[model samples]
Target: MSLSSLRRQDAAVVRSSLALRPLALAVHMLAVGAAVTALPVYAAEPTEEAVTLDAVSITGEAEGGLSDVTEGTQSYTTRAAKTATPLKMSLRETPQSVTVVTQQRIQDQDLQTIADVVNNTVGVSLNRYETSRGQINARGFELNSLMIDGVPTIYEQPWSSGEIFGSLAMYDRVEVVRGANGLMTGAGDPSASLNMVRKRANSKELTGSVEVSAGTWDTYGTLGDLSMALNEEGTIRARLVGEYNDGDSWIDHHTNKRETFYGTMDIDLSEDTTLWFGASRQENNSDSPAWGGLPVWYSDGSETNWSRSTSMSTDWSKWDTTYESYFVNLEHTFANDWHAKLGYTRGERDGDSYLIYPFGSPDPVTGLMGGYGAGSYKTNTTQDDYYLQVDGPVELFGRSHDVAFGYTHSDQDFDADTRGYIPTANYDFNDFYDMPEPDWQPLTDSDASETTQKALYAATRINLADDLKVILGVRSTDYEKEQGNSKIKEDDEITPYAGIVYDLTENLSAYASYTDIFLPQSQHDINDNQLNPIVGESYETGLKAEFFDGRLNASAAVFRIKQDNLAESTGLFIPGKTPPTFAYEEGDGATSDGFELEINGELAPGWNLMAGYTQFDVEDADGEDVNTQYPTKMIRTFTTYRVPGFLGDKLTIGGGVNWQDSIYVYAANPSGVAEKVEQDAYALVNLMARYEITENLSAQLNANNVTDEKYMDFFEAYGAFTYGAPRSLTASAKYSF
Candidate 1:
């Protein structure tokens, strides 16, 4: 198809704030001001009394290695992380920018899903393709890699059942590592990596908690968690968590429900060994989901705006998704102070969606719009991932160093079925609002595919000096894929990583890193042969600091990334094909450059803060900005303060603001006129308050989009746009023992 013809066909087809009393407000203000002034100045030499606040707390033996704080706390800063490197090092020593959303933060913010957390994460942005599917981007590139308990999995449909809609009930904390993580994650972009740390069975005594919540739009949900020791010695423990959610959306005729269950067991095989096994299931169902957004332009080449609650889908449209996983792990420590671990995981995800994709712009004069195309698709994906690794001290050049080696293997299978047909009753733009449902036909087999990967990796932390360290790592991967009648294979692909960190002071450090990027490509070349995998490189330099005895952390970094072998179509057409076929070639790829500054943790004993600023630009080889529809600058911040005396530490209040620069994209109207649609700069505000009615009971309220800011959340080059969510509120009550 020619450019003009393709354009024509694409056009047709694609077509709350909280209230405050004056006296209560003044008290709150004075308390807030006092707390702010009490914060310790990070760099200045502390006075005699200031030293008391920064006192360090130490627990547990080091076991002759670096120890970490794995438990979650209300403070924004976490003591350690596994995503930055295999060795659990504090954020300040990891040589990377890391963010941790602890359990306390999750509850304080009422974050129910992965999307909610990503939206509030600094240096991250959320984009929804439609009402039901969305994606998260960091540093101007899409994030495709996710880890659960340190095990990695690539998203087959990120917008559908991947991290986008993952439940938060079963997770203890969410860890985000910015920049390239290709060293341990295998194949992925340098954008970022997200790790969901599961809540372990750590209770030595019987302990449980239950929570219930209700919010705007008739949203209601409940969560139950129980844990107990199975033996007198408390050597064996088990935990179970379950959650249910049902809610009506802001859009007309749209509703959604979700259910989740998780169970885990921990056993001590001996004083030096331990075992863990677990299983989980999650299901989501949506009724009357919008297939696509309203038209952005009229036939007259003029812009159009619609109400936020408008819907183009009928009552019959629905999307149902289910995901299940099972995992087992064994860990042991030897008398020589060496540690070893073996892990295995298997999971499956399935989704069924019935949609009506309406295309084309409406006629301004006649109010006539193009009709809709109806379709349904069901997909099932199964994956198996396992790895073995061992780390210990090695004496090289009379210096003790930490070394680790591992082998990993993964297998995946996928199948899909689809059916589509035109509705028996059709209407034009004049009757678009009242269009009826389509008569769908039976489903038929679509396609099947299989993928397998094997890798060998090794790394070491060399102690160059008492105050300096160096990390070197490399991964060798073998990959294979079989889809339909096409088969592809690649062997001996190697990716290297290196980093160095120097302590500038007891509480500050500077670091630099270089990482090679590797990503498997599914696109084929003009001759139908799978193109070479996209390979890239990244360089980053940064400074990190910790304050208040590691209770607060901050970092600033600059980075640049480049990739090649990007898939680009030739635009030449092949006849005798239902939709016409076009070949592809390895093209000059993408480049991104950016900087970020972030700070998170307890600013004071009663004050918790998280704030970040990001600026980045991505461009194609031709030097044109890519994804210009996304803002290049953003600022995010939120904080909570505990008020003393009157409430006896029973009341906590906080708020947050998110601001982004304007975004714009170029597109062609139905009349073949070129135009730009843009969303101006906007700021969203949110407020929250939680009060302890009793020692074991608490009540909390949260209001989002207090100002009811309205703006475009997402847009495409073909004249389609989606609006941001409207104002909303939620209230919850929790009981615990």
Candidate 2:
């Protein structure tokens, strides 16, 4: 272990030097990445419930005079997406709170990943930890539903990015369903669902793009996407996307890297049907399996701000992970008013990493924070999953009604191993630090185990009238786990969902929705059996409007939610026969409420706006503050305008601003927490100007974090903290054909 630590420590020095590498070159490559086309013309362009038959076409993208409007209440698409946008419309006309982050906006703001995009959208809060290194939540709810081309892709928890990183490059536009989608989505805890629309083969010719980026912390990476027609008729389409990113964490000594490869094929199985077959693979590298996500402060019990730079593992800190997935989908349209679809997906994951954190130390003869005997969770994960769903339209009465119903299921599993080493187990605390990298000392024994889950769900949509619609759905899941124990930890649960949309006028509407999301507990009972899955429900209502025939849209909404089956983790409770351990007590809770308002669309001749406000409260079973870890009230906004360019509208300039109020951070437990730290509200500004040197070529510049405000981004219960990013700027030239 000592030898391993020395090598890693040496690597750290090299890494620190690497972080200082120039990023301007990387930015130049990225800014020109997507604009790879050359010289002819510089042109660019850019969720259902469990209900089976959804009929509402409530979106800002409906084109051709909104002639093909669905009977449903809301839906939106990009200028070139699932649906065409109406002619010359304003965003305020859409009857839903929508925020469209255009590619131009993405570039202007230097948005790096999908997370960056969502973080910019209104009413959307990204809650993630630099440590723990996993999971994205909205409205304090874990994101469970992900849609690719309208197909649901549920990411398994305790899972790695080997699966998610694939979607980042292939995505063309990202649409978010802010509330319950149980009608077709099945089960959700009432947070938000995201749909990643893929770049299609709609173009007549060939198109490709590649991007590279480098930023603070020596972060540099590349992504490539290429699309082509496989048939003379241009009916069959093929697309491939790949990526490679390697970088370090904000903290010292931590490292991360990932690579992705994906291929997708689309065939006109028939005029009325399209067939999709695709696969993706991702590889990940890291030293710590714990993902540095664990809190640094020990709830005021001990080790308060001890050392933020301490390595969690003494040895075996490097982790290697990989994931592969394949999927098949069919979309068929019949001569009748009926349409049906089916899809199946298979995914697999494997990982091996080391976990090292100071568990405890003995009394020091001299004294130091370090000690010998240490335990580590070093292991491999092997997971496989399968999912299936089918849906079509159904008519009930004479009144025109559209309906769709579908069922989905998946099986997931993982294994984690724990290892402990006491190379001088008898050494006194004083000598622990005296010995070089004592935590890296020799290993002793190791143990392993796994957890599995199975889920089933269905949903549908029903059109009530020319102005009203209803959506409903449900999902049932079973969670089972075994951790070196004979008894099995089993749990069965069901979540329900519903939504309604009412059109008051051709350009105005009202909508309401509810959904429940569920998840199995990560903590196990004394029996080593998994605990019951936690469940949450969300209820929401809102009003929306669309103008210029749905070219633009705006909306206001309010919601309330409740969560149950939460683990208290008292750190004070012990099972009857179980020895006193980490007190993770069990408890139930509910009652969280919030209101939101937002606007997204073309407001004027060439102006756009995306803004939102939210006030919320989350409590425990006793109706007390459980979500005090974060802020309760916040507002965000962004606006941009494409001025009638000079030299015949060829010279374009635009800019935007992002601002937020102070947020509350919890440094300790509710009882022992330090004084709440109030983060001063700050804003970041960005500007962009492009000159059409030729029809196909142009020069552009982008600046981000304009204010250079120094601030903290995230804070955890254990007092762990990370700082926000500093300012950055980039310039590039592009050619499109």
Candidate 3:
């Protein structure tokens, strides 16, 4: 909700970028400062050319929010690193719509939760609720890919409607790569990929900071981040972040509290090679977890579906979960301008949520008793992953080419169980009033179900000419699942990708890319016949440029995505041994095609900006032109301006607007007629000004939803809708040595 604080954070990055010497490390750090340091949202504007083409070594987005553009961006990047550290370059240097929510930004805005951070980020939507369970919607796709320090940490465990509630308190910055990333991702959903960078050793000597906050609903919390340099050479550094959050929501039947501890170490083995290691541990406990979405309307079965509010359940027990993860990565460079990077990680998640919802109990037609059925269920999840990558300048024929090649593999496992239950409801009660807390059924034993997957993939990038560059990639996955006494194994074929970029000027470039992904079947069909996974592909083209030695940047892009041979299951045969049966009913495919334009950069003095817009058109390959659930278009913009000299030297004022177009969901009919549920387009205006009380202390007032924009965040699965948030505000102060 706080936008101003974010702007000041950007000012801090600009300040840092300006102060750092032109050391490779300093350049790398400053260029990408916006992501990890929490820079203010007010980025500078795009000028003539962001980065000079001669210096356009990497396809640039590096023109960054602080940098300007000579050519359009081949991609749109969030913020650049503080310095021009090629090894640790900024996101702008990467040709993609990548955003970095830095640590400073995290503090300035008082963004205490992961959901809060995602909301402030461009091109992302929150589909998840509750502290223990979380979900995020991206470019009309559900996110299923995640990494910690460039290591795989995502699994099939998202039961509370998502994998787990992630906290932002321990992170340095969040990196998001929009669109299909299966080329480097190995095996997973192509929707998008997120890399949560943990706080690493930064203090040249010894430094630390602590933050505490209290908000509505008795919400209170504390956070601490510390760092130390073990040697004068500053080659060995260590950082630690810890947080404890305890609170209750407006819900009547739930209580919850959570804690986390994270530690990271970085050693500059040598100027050519650096090694890093990170670990994280988290714990959560909650009661009456909203098993699912609240009904759109209640009692009379009338849709109360109102805006500015949404709710889950009451009295969901212990609902506890534990997450433990560790990772190690190394990067090296050769005299021939070649570089190699390798990383490995292990992650594990265990938890359960208990709930029994209303099901098959009644028929108004017969009144013979069949309105709702009740049952208790629990789920268990686990995961393991490994990856290796290497890219360098290589020789092809007689041409000197910039080549990048890498490979990755992943293995994951998941299981669940359910038991019978009895409820006090034989009658229809949408209000959930006068409900009965009946006793449990003495079922004999708990039933179990399990699933697993293994994948391997490789990819490469080639620079064919000074004006033309290309990239290619491929991946394969082996998957399996077991239910009761039955098991099934399947294979997802090769996923490949290719791209090309053309430099129009010394500061401008145009590029195009094609990427693909293969997804596995959801559940088993009747006769337990196997169904192939869908092959999804994306086509994109855009422009890019960098400015101010990569201090500022800007980009614009357009794309088209399509999926073929989609598998639709049908309940064909009946009375089978496997119990539940499904059939693969081949149908028309689905395609999402759209155009996007983004402007990001820092203007002269102390101004910063980041904005993006997306428009989508999707339908079955048969061309029925169905009203898609995804927004037709979205645009979000934010900026900040620092005051001149005197008493105002340390003060900054900033704010921006975020808007989204209407969306449509299937109608109320059993057949689901396409009901164009129009979500009125609303712009969120935010304001904030920060003043440095001291070199180590600062205070900021952040206000969000300035206009009290009302809207729906999610609707589709079981019900019609859930509303978004209303005008809200928060304030905070921070101190750092």
Best candidate (score: TM-score): 1
RMSD of each: 7.9, 12.0, 10.7
Ranking by TM-score: 1, 3, 2
- How displaced is residue 630 in candidate 2, in Å? 2.4
Cα distance off (Å), candidate 1, residue 580: 11
Backbone N/Cα/C clashes per model? 6, 70, 102
Q: Compared with the true structure, what per-residue lDDT tens digits does model 3 show for residues 1-737?
A: 22234334433442343221223422333334334234443345643433311111221222212342222231223334311111223433344555655544555456666666666666666654233455665665566666655555674444543343667766656666667766555445545667665655545578887766665456677778888887888888888989888876645455668788999787878866668778888877776655544444343333454323333443433476777877777766667756576777777777655554443322333322224444454555556655555555567876755444455555555555555556554654334423454465543435444555555554444556767665555666666766566666666666676766676665555667777666665544455556566666777766666554544555555666676656665656534645545566544466665555555556544666666666655555654333344455677676666677946588867787777665544433323332234455567787777777888887777777788766664445555445554565555566777
Q: Between the candidate structures 1 and 3, which one is better when assessed by TM-score? A: 1
| TM-score head-to-head 2 vs 3, winner | 3
Q: Name the candidate, 1 or 2, with the larger lDDT value.
A: 1
TM-score between model 2 and native: 0.72
lDDT of 2 by residue, 1-737 (tens): 34234334433442343221123422332332222222123223422211111111112122223232111212222322221011112233222234455444554455545677666776566545444343445565556656555444544435343333333555445656655444334434556666665444333367765556665557677767677888798678887888778776645566678787888777777776777678878777764433333333342344333233434443345567676777777766567734455666666666554444332322222333332334444344444444443434566786644333444454444555555444543433322223333344444435444545455655555667777776665666655555554334444567676767787766566677676666556665555445566667677767666554343455666677777777766444445544555445457765666666665544544555556666665555543444333445556665655557457767666666666555555454323534444457677776666667787666666666777766554545334444444566555555544
Please list the residue runs of candidate 1 whose C-alpha ends up more than 4 Å from where it truly belongs after superposition.
1-72, 158-163, 364-367, 428-434, 522-530, 569-585
TM-score, one value per model: 0.89, 0.72, 0.78
The whole-model lDDT of each prediction reads: 0.76, 0.52, 0.56
